[model samples]
Target: MYISAFPTFSFSKLIKRKKAQVFSDYFGYENTRFFYRGAYAIFYGVKALGLKPKDTVLVPAYHCGIEINAILKAGINVKFYDVTHELEVDIESIKSNIDEHTKAVFVIHYYGFPQEMVSLNKLCQTHGLKVIEDCAHGLFSFYKSKSLGAWGDISVFSFQKSLPTADGGAIVFNDRKEDCFITQKKPALLTTLRAYLLLYSEHIHMFKGFLFSVFNTLILKPSRFILKILKRGGSKVITANTNEFDAQYVSLGPSGITEKLIDSIDAHGIVVNRRRNYQHLLEGTKHIKNIKLLFNNLPVGVCPLFFPIRVNQRDLMQQYLSDHGIETFIFGKKLHNLLPKEQCPVAWAYSDELLCLPIHQDMNPGNIEYILKVLEDENCPLN
Candidate 1:
């Protein structure tokens, strides 16, 4: 079976409850503010803080474009900061970009690799800028003993991305005090409907993975119009581009389901399995010439979302892997280009060469060996 970089959920217990009941049991809550998704969490965070329009916010040039939209939706101007070759934000560029108008800095922990938060926090303090850590990709990740989300003045985590939740986001404030904004009572009906639908979708996907892949690759590939419509409707809200910030806030339900799921995952040793698979990939491909592994160690504390490799022939290697049923990803393909050609030169270079390879919980040592062998046979310069 082909491995996916995305996280999976096991919902056998969730499937037993009525969708409405599940929503009420899991989503509705007091003492917590909610939004449609993470982007809205960001939107509300900025609004709740009462940031004025035209205030400048510094963001990594190479990031999910939706982040730009989120900042814009909050009526703030965004400035781009360059990223290092390792994909972390360039500290110097961040320092250079700071000015009186700079009110906040949003940092993305790319691919679950925690950025140098200590330095970033110091930088923010020096400039009197508030920090918003976008933990959409770095949920549950830590920097030293501190959590990534905890470092920022305000932080947001996308439960949809890291957790198995259908759609949810949470905002943590620096002072841990609740501030006033447009708030709402939890939507029990919607929460229940979404949870059950997500649970059902998982089962359907597992049972018909091959069929779905065929339909998506073959049937959906040629139908750009249909795909566009589907894309617009299918949680496009999560992407930074879709701006529906003015929409009403709805509770993502609560932490009961997420806590249970996390407990179950721990009980089943999924984290260990994920780490072991990551280690297998790292060990298997350590000597691949012209391909540099971003980190020297098996990434710990922050579970790697994918095993990323920077290769000279990234596009070719990706095709080579795909042809052999070993899937790969080209994350942030147009990241730097989206900013400006000459603005972030190193980020542009890194974007072209980086390829994220599969290292999910589903893969085994045999799978890792097979992928390595295929690369070796293809004259992929395995040292």
Candidate 2:
């Protein structure tokens, strides 16, 4: 049972298409545009809000460097604010960093968990700073009965995180004071094909159904050997966040099929299953000895991307889980060089401590049981 860290793709969902809806569709932001990646969407959204390189934007100290890079590539000066070990945006830190040059603040809903948005919004409003909601891990997430993306001046989503797509992302303008960006042309054929192939391989490899098992034995195995023979087998794709933001590909939209893939998505079912799977992990791991669940109380309407836990020895635990075929990883272990570790000790501490387990919609109770069983086993890092 080789579980995946992220959701795997499948053709069956696309074939049973009904409504052409996405998580953002319910937000009804009128002004939404798709992009090749969430990082590109961030770049476009920040620029669209009339923020220039000379202006400063407050971002959390703990984050994937890609968003920081996006703001930097747009020439915006970023002021790193402290995020408490709770992963909530530190409001006082935001106040300390704000100045005349501060035009906006990027609020990341980390791991599909909402921040203190009502207060954060009020604070941003008082300062006249635009709130840029980074929903990279929060596609369908809601905070206090309202959508997480809806609380911001503008919001960006990474569809690939929540949906099974090759390459897709979006930027929704909630209160645009400046002109929004026009949709760019599609990416190169090779780029799109390579992205799909990477997803396809994961789908087949992770597929457990008898139908896919036969196909895997007959088709996938041979395809891997042939690709190896041709030296064409690789999972690398020119998607967002893998490298620095490229201006050349900045305007490019998602692949032609990405929209269709999203259209066919089981939006409601995915939400239900993910929440269910997450609850299973929460309840099953209650008796665990060493690990701490970051957000132990799963709030209603929050769409969790994973079950995150803080362990004393994250590397040891992660390796043990990987060795047992339970895919897991630490989040935000690599901070941007510009972020001072000395200034944000808590963020640095979390960087070394947090581990995220797979809790995607496809995972079942059995998978969750296996994960917990491995955690309690003698070879476990805690033991």
Candidate 3:
């Protein structure tokens, strides 16, 4: 039984008709605009913030390259800020980078752990730089008593990453002056059709059997491939969130199905189950001498996105886990051209070493134990 990093969808979630629900309270935003992907949310956030062309913004060296693309699409210039091996922002690096043209500072709360927002916010305020929090991983996370997304001038969230939704993204504006709702055209029907197929594939993947794995590898992969060749721009649906940036898809909003799926979610249960799964991984890996857990303690109110670990043989370990029916992720190993690998050694090293294991709400205790046993395999070459 492979444990996926993201949640598997249920047919019940798709067919049931529910009343339209507002998620402002859950996401800590009074208003939000949904998009087809997280990159679009960021794209519009820059526009809403009035960041003009050639206006520089400080961004973390540790990032998904798509964000850099979104900023560039908005015609904004980007400067790099270093992040520590422990995934914390280097405040001094950020301070040194801020200059006359810098209009905003982009902050990413990697793996749903909140950064030192108070310190970072103070520094941004000192230079009068607007803070754009990238809470793509921090949807249900908190820093002290405040939610991760609430602290920024504007925040970007990805429902696809954290929720069981097929495709969705959102932007929350803290400053009402920049708060304007957008009415983006609905995603294409072909896109919506692919979303359903992918969702069902995820549901089928939740079943524990070699037959299921074969079905996923054979049926789902081929179906998606054929969809790519037959439909218009279907390849983007498969590769939407990878390192590559697609300008053509930037203006699109989420499908109606995505909105309905989000409305059906149990927000509190997501946080609880994710936190529990995180602790299971934490406990399982705590005693291992060969690797280091990037984050050891789960703070109160923080919903962990994954269990990040550092090892010399990251690529090998990821393949090993995949072979054993567990999915692992490597976070943002590709550095954008704006921030070369040579300039940010720490972040580059982290990009190479960090492997994110699944801790989503979908996995049961049995699933957790199986993943742990694989991690502790003595025969494994990667120590």
* Decoy 2 TM-score against native: 0.91
lDDT, model 1: 0.65
Poorly placed runs, candidate 3 (over 4 Å): 14-22, 27-30, 177-183, 208-229, 232-239
User: For residues 1-383, what per-residue lDDT tens digits would candidate 2 score against the true structure?
Assistant: 67878887766766646564774366653677888988888988888888976899999998878889988988899989998878899899999999999999998998899998999989998999999999989988888888878889999988877788867788888885336446588877656665676677667656654456677677767766665664455533365437466777888888878877877776778888899999998998888877688988789998999899888889988998999878885668898999975878988888888899999987888888988899889889877
lDDT value for candidate 2?
A: 0.82
**Taking the tens digit of each residue's C-alpha lDDT, what string does model 3 give over 172-271?**
8877744655657777777677777766676676674546768778887888678868756433444344566677777688888788777777677788
RMSD of model 2, in Å?
3.0
Candidate 1 vs 2: which has more TM-score: 2
What is the lDDT, from 0 to 100, of the residue 349 in candidate 3? 85
Question: Model 3's lDDT to the true fold?
Answer: 0.81
Query: What's the C-alpha lDDT at position 288 in model 1?
Result: 65
* Over 4 Å off, model 1: 13-34, 184-270, 336-338, 379-383
CA RMSD per model (angstroms): 6.3, 3.0, 2.8
Q: State the lDDT at 158 in candidate 2.
A: 85
